[model samples]
Target: MTSASLGMAHTSSQAAILDVIRAAGTISRVELTRATGLTGATISTVVRRLINEGLVLEVGRAESTGGKPRMLLQLDPTARFAIGVHLDHAGITYVVSNLGGAIVTRWRQPGAGSDSPAEVVARIVREIGGMIARTGIDRSRVLGLGVVSPGPITAAVGMVLTPPSMESWTEYPLAEALEDGVGVPVLLDNDATASAVGEYWAGGIEPTSAFAALYMGTGIGAGVLVNGTVYRGASSNSGEIGHICVDIDGPPCWCGSRGCVEILAGPAAVVTAARAAGLDVGPAERSVAESFAAVARAALRGEPTAAAILQRSARYLAVAAHTLANIMDLDLVVLTGPSFALAGSLYLPAVEDLLSTAFFARQSHPVRVTISTNASDSAAVGAAALVLQSELAPRQSGARLQAELGPEPVPAQGRTSVVGSLG
Candidate 1:
């Protein structure tokens, strides 16, 4: 065989073995051989390589089944680290995570509201350094930095097609700028997609065949996990549930659709409805996010007016949730994001009730519904997980992100519905 082919085969085998070890939590060499369908000799060679790479470690021995006890192999969670940052209109969040996708430390800062791209990038560089320094994590140990936000990320060009939310921060080279400042590779992805990956990697969430991380903030989107990996559809942006029409004659959306979920039921829509009704959510000067949160807080406080407002929004969201559950045949639905974090209590039962009784395949398997524990920081945490996923389990259904190139200046006049994705 050719030398290149031999090297490729060797690496593939090592990746396969490591994946099995990670999935099994702690496994013996004999079990790995069985799981991988590789010979004992091949497993031993690959495992030795993984151990040498500091990716796997020997944790005590398993119970003796027959001869001598076998050494249990497990992933070395601390062998690597990744930084995640979420850039948004309301807040910028940062988190440092270990190899196993568990957060080690986290920090929060003000969002990049009306700030120039250069100014925000400078702050991000400084904070990432602070996180690394305070956590005492060696710089070499950091695999990369993952950034998630609302812009249209075209991984190939490394240029973001800025969205209307971050209006002033357009035509900037986000990936190249950050990478140059931090001296580490940077990955830029949308918040909804990142949230789904975070849900998969988070220790708090249970594994399922199909699930959706429904992220609700200024807008609404879903990150779908099918068969343990993200399902990045045709254009690499599959889960924009917000654009789906929930009402034909409700209202027109920026996407040129009438009665889309975002316009009819998103946080902005909810806040607008509340204000129109003279509910004291907040003054007009307050940000939409703040007013929406105030409404949620009041709902939680058992105010009838507030409860009715949030409940109406939840019902609209539940329509989208039910439609998603039926189409995906999902076994789990995780509500997350800034809006869901504050108002999940109102949204939960509405979604749960519909899925329980109305799901198409309820007889086969009942779907479960819950809120994301990291809802507030899901994008940031998932951004870190993207780094770990690329290094550890590179095998996925969708295409990998293309190598980034020099950034191009693009106008935000027309933003495409689809963006880059991690699949």
Candidate 2:
């Protein structure tokens, strides 16, 4: 074969070997050949290339079945790093992580709001630079930045398409601005999508299982993982659970809906209810954290009023969970986000009870509900996972890429649908 043909063959062999190592997590050259359908000579050639590139490392010796022990090859997680940023109405969280998504360093900044796009990008770039310096990771090893913001987002071009909570951030060229500021590629995804990816990576869920992540924060969002892949709908806004109306005419939501989940059970909703009960709730945003903590403290001390408010929020959340389960036929539900840390205990039991009773698949199998282990930082970590996935396992780009680059911008529209009886 010609030199060019030989090079192409070697590249294919290297890709195959890398695929085996990623799938096995750790495996010997003999095992890699068996897993990848590559010959022993091909595996040896590819493994040397991988080691030379610092992408794979010989960790230890694996036990042999009936032959000499072989050196185990594993992905060099520390060989590269990625930065993940979670942009929320409450705060902005930054995490620098290795290829495996283990956070090496973290930083927090004020959340995105009425600030100009340039201002927000500048702050993010400053924080990222500081984090990179502190971590001492070579700039060349840095993959890119993954920014997770609340929906609706255009994942393809990385734009924030007028999320309800941050009205001033409409039609923001978020990814381009951040990339220009930081001088690196920036991937923007919905916070819920990031949370789901984070859960998949850090939460120890089986990679092939279908799971739904309900992220409760300033607003509610859901992330649907179908067979280990995030399922973004036609407009990259599949999991807009906040606008799922539980009460038809109860209260007005900023999204122009009445008695939507966001209006009924978001942090603002809980604080409003608490104040109406004469609890002296402070500012809508600041008081949310303080008020929820007070309520959690009071409830732990057996205060009925605070406990009742928490229960009410949980009940509403349970309704949404049930609705989501019915629509998606999901078996596992993960509750995550800062709001979960505040009111998880209250939300978990109520959600479990409702799912057990009213889930559409209750007769066939039990729906499992659990809080995300890294509840407060799921989105941030998932943002990191976005970078890892882009580097490791990018999806086939056909219609998805075209849709991402199309001229039609995502409309700032919200919908409310009552799935079933709330009771």
Candidate 3:
């Protein structure tokens, strides 16, 4: 073969080796050679380059199989870091995490409701700077920033087109403005997609399973994962479960639909219902715990009116969940986001009951519905995961901060590690 052709072949082989290492976590050179069907010489050369680039490190020696001990190689999880920001009508959450999705630093601030696009972007830039300073992580090693916001979003242009509850942020250039302020790559995605990715990375689930993430926050959205990859539909807006109409002649929704899931079960609907039932819902500035306590207290105190309002909301949410289960035919569904923290008790059982009884595949399959252990902050974590994924496996459109930050070094063979084993 020509010399140029040989060079191209070698480059492709090295990329394949990196892919294997990223999947395996910690692997010996001999094992890598066997896994990739590459020559020992090629593996050694690639490993040397990876080490020189500070991406791979020789962690320790591997078990001896009646022969010389092999040196184990691992991806330097701390070699780089990424920032995740969750933007909602309720608040703004920022998280600094390593490649493995472990949180190193986090900050939560009041919601950016009335703030203009520029004002909110400036605040976000300031908060991110503070987070980086507090963590003492090198700016060079920080990959980029990922922002998860309420949908529906125009992912192609990085804009929050029209968030149902966040009326002040119509057509906001959130991603572009943040990128300009921070001088780094920024990605904007649906909050549900971010929550789903967070659950996929942090929730110990079967790697091969198809899962659905139903996030109930200011409004409802669903994130679908099939075979370990997020499925963003044609417009990158697939998970608008809130607009799904279940009651044609019922309450009108902000989206001009009658009895949509959001109108029937979102916080606005519940709070409105509660207020109409003669209970004080409390001020808007209190902690989420206080708000949830209000709901729980009203429900547990034998106030039939308050209890009836929550039950109605829960029942509507269950209908949405059942619709999602039938459409996705998923094996697992995870409930997440701040709204679910207190309301889950009222919603979870109703969903489980409905799915067990009326799901399209009820007789042929069983659907598991569970609340996320990381409910309060799943979207923020998923935003971090978005940065990690973009760094490790950039799409054809290329890295968001390609001009500012050079390509992330490929993870070494056997460098991927899960914090805990999956069931």
Q: What does candidate 3's lDDT look like per residue over 1-423, in tens digits?
A: 222332232225554455456556789998888766777898899889878877678989988888889999877878778899998766899899875567898788987776776788898899899889888998878777788888766533444456544676776666667766786666667789888877876637654567888898777888887655667765566777888898899888777779898887777777767767678779766543345458657786877877788788888888888887888888888999887866677778898999898888878878898999878888998888867655553333221223222222111111221111000
Spell out the clash pairs found in candidate 1.
none
Model 3, residue pairs in steric clash: 21-413, 21-414, 25-414, 25-415, 25-416, 26-414
lDDT of 2 by residue, 257-348 (tens): 78898888887777777888887445655635566666666776777887898888888888988998998888899999888976787789
Assess each prediction's global lDDT (C-alpha) against the native.
0.76, 0.72, 0.71
Best by TM-score: 1
Model 3 ranges off by over 4 Å: 1-49, 65-71, 155-160, 283-293, 296-307, 362-364, 394-423
| TM-score between candidate 1 and the true structure | 0.88
The local distance difference test score of model 2 is 0.72
**Predicted structure 3, TM vs. truth:** 0.81
Across residues 250-345, which tens digit of lDDT does each residue of candidate 1 receive?
A: 888866779998888888888898888888876777777899999998889998888998888888888888999999899889999989988998
Candidate 2, clashing residue pairs? none
| Model 3: lDDT of residue 185 | 65
Please tell me which predicted candidate would have the highest lDDT against the true structure: 1
